[model samples]
Target: MKKSLVILITILLSAVIYGCSSSSEAENADNNTEDKPTLTLGQTNWTSTIVPTQIVKQILEDMGYNVEVQDAELGAVYTGLSTADVDIFMDSWSPQQDQYMEEYSDSIERISASYEDAGAGMVVPEYMEDINDVGDLKGREDIVNNEILAISEADPAMEDLQDIIDAYDLDMEMVNSSEGAMLAAAEAKIEEQEPVVLYGWEPHSMFQQLDLKILTNEKVPEIYGDTSIHVTVQNGLQEKAPEAYNFLSNWSISIDDMTEMITKIDDGQNSEDVAQTWIENNQDEIDNMKSN
Candidate 1:
């Protein structure tokens, strides 16, 4: 009876040990799904910037890659990529952001076109028929409150805008406010069908949510704005994480879809939730990139 009791105790102890080992292995496998090759995404603190960055971040996380996004001024984002502190940045608006890009040209590598021919520069209500050109605002300061609603003070574009204003000898003042402030001011003006112009960019929800038109940068098209909000990766990103690098290189989005997504996101929807929903609805697009 004593020997049988001892044998039973040994069997039960062995079973417990085996069960724990199996559980540990299962946990490790689950963790491995999200293990190494973590991606560091850098972004400027703007809705347009955040949307695509979060979208890609979520996509990578879904693909079992770890992602961490660090937000900073546009200049800092570029600096991060230059220093390899950031693995990738999806929206590098050229011509518009040429000044920032100029600094890291040698240290960074552009991997893909996040959005081809994306718009940027001053924007105004379509009803402002006379305001067809950026220079039109020069003499019409009274209607626009002598204030151009601009993004935060740190935006490198602010210098360009000042240059534009100075070049045109405009009597307008740029109100250095947050993006939300600018949008709110724009919304009120639009509601009253009043004239308002704010620093605008395409692939943003403003196009979908308002009857706005981009003020032509005829004054300095060559030096001002163009397109191709390209995806940029740290120089060694491809070598360090080929899967992520490939996915970003193959990624593409229609301007229409991006604008619509932005509109939804601006309507108080969570960005992650919106992006996940976008992925589900556009699985073909995402899947196609994956295979490529």
Candidate 2:
């Protein structure tokens, strides 16, 4: 009887000790998670925005951060940053986005240019020989069915396009569409050697697969001229997340490289997988970004 009681007591004690250890381990895990910095990234609804934002999110996660991405329109992105509802934005075009910065100057700040001299403006296929300038399209609106292909209305580019129309007094109407749909329409036009004018920007896959030309007219002030894409964050990010701030301060990717990734992503590959592959292939570059 005594021996059986001792064995039973020993088993109960062992089970209690095991249960306590497991509970302690779970509590420690929760503590560790709580200790990590949680960051919110404000992502604009554009593939260009999606690509870099994911890359940065993954890099920060690798650096022990709890990162969350929140999608919003360009204007909402600025609002979120200003109010500190969002922590970072990886793709803000300089000078082009200067108005937003000026408005939120007190609450938001720019870290560095992710890529420089990014050309953005209206674009047309190389086959459109006669339609070389924006003014050339003033009277030739019938050629493109009096339509200018453009991305979402949520994009600030659409507003700029509207301003251009008002400035140049072009009769053509701006057609609103998603980037993928606009590209598809552009591709169909290109395949048939038809004329297509649409919003285009560098560090994009469209430039790689399609032979297009950016049009310029001195008649109106240049809105999309060469602009640097910047990494922007809320005002206190540098102090709140010093490590992340340093990494972003050193962030940059070649336009060619970004275009390649965009091409692969457009071809149906996963964005996270593409980013991971790029990170693996460019360890030295990533290391530098993480350092400063």
Candidate 3:
């Protein structure tokens, strides 16, 4: 009887051990299946980028994504995306950003177009009817004396502007300052009805508030070298967060739409308010993108 009882106890212990092992494996599998993916978005320090980034964030949140926004430099953003530190970037300007793209194409994925025809050029107040084009600036140098040409800090466009200046031999001096400072200067001048010429671009709040006109030039191409800002994703982001990637791939906004949102934000509306208002106004567009 003792021998039979020992054999029975050993068999029961073996069964219990096997059951626990199977349960542990199943639990691990369940945990792996239930894990949620986190996505990172990279943003540049420009109003054009900021408004759109916020808009993109709202759309992704609506689709149930864990999203993080990282303020990054132009070059660093590309590097981050290549290394998977950033999962998405919505502000990749091409031709201008072509160098980075070529270098990192192996690691990162170019997803879709964000905005096209983001034109850049020198702009003057509407009152300056005399200066219709870049070439006209040379004849009116006396009138534009102390006329500060404001520009963003370390902008790549400055190089092109410099080339134009050198090629045309214009007398106007280009003033380098932060975007805020430049806008402040331009706004102050505009308020006083003083003549001011500054570097400006589309899809910016300044377009809505300031009565400025972009100076046409034969030298500078109309479309800035066929450059369109693009959406980019990390190598495996599509597989990890397919929903978010799909939404991003379909994301696009017109220059007019962005300008209005930027105008609201510049007028002291909060970023979220600006974004929410724009999203509400453009519900159909947003729905179509999301549905697709």
- Per-residue lDDT tens digits for candidate 3, residues 186-231, read 8888898877778887768776588888878776663345658888
Error of 1 at 50 (Å): 2.2
| Alpha-carbon deviation at 263 in model 3, angstroms | 0.5
TM-score of every model?
0.85, 0.85, 0.80
Q: Which stretches of candidate 3 lie over 4 Å from their true place?
A: 1-34, 146-148, 222-227
Predicted candidate 2 versus true structure: per-residue lDDT over 1-292, tens digit per residue:
9999999999999999999999999999888777778999998767788889989999999888899999888899999999999999999987678889999999999988888988877899988888777888888888889888998887766788788888888888878888879989999999999888899988788876898888885676567766799999999898888889999999998888888888899889999999888888988999987875
Candidates 2 and 3 compared by lDDT, better number: 2
- Candidate 3 clashes between residue pairs 3 or more apart in a chain or in different chains: none
Please give the CA lDDT of all the candidate structures.
0.83, 0.87, 0.78
Clashes of each: 0, 0, 0
Off by over 4 Å in 1: 1-35
lDDT of 1 by residue, 77-131 (tens): 8889999998898888766677767778788977788777777778898889988
Model 3 residue 219 lDDT score: 65
Candidate 2 root-mean-square deviation in Å: 3.7
What's model 2's lDDT at 13?
A: 100
Better of 2 and 3 by TM-score: 2
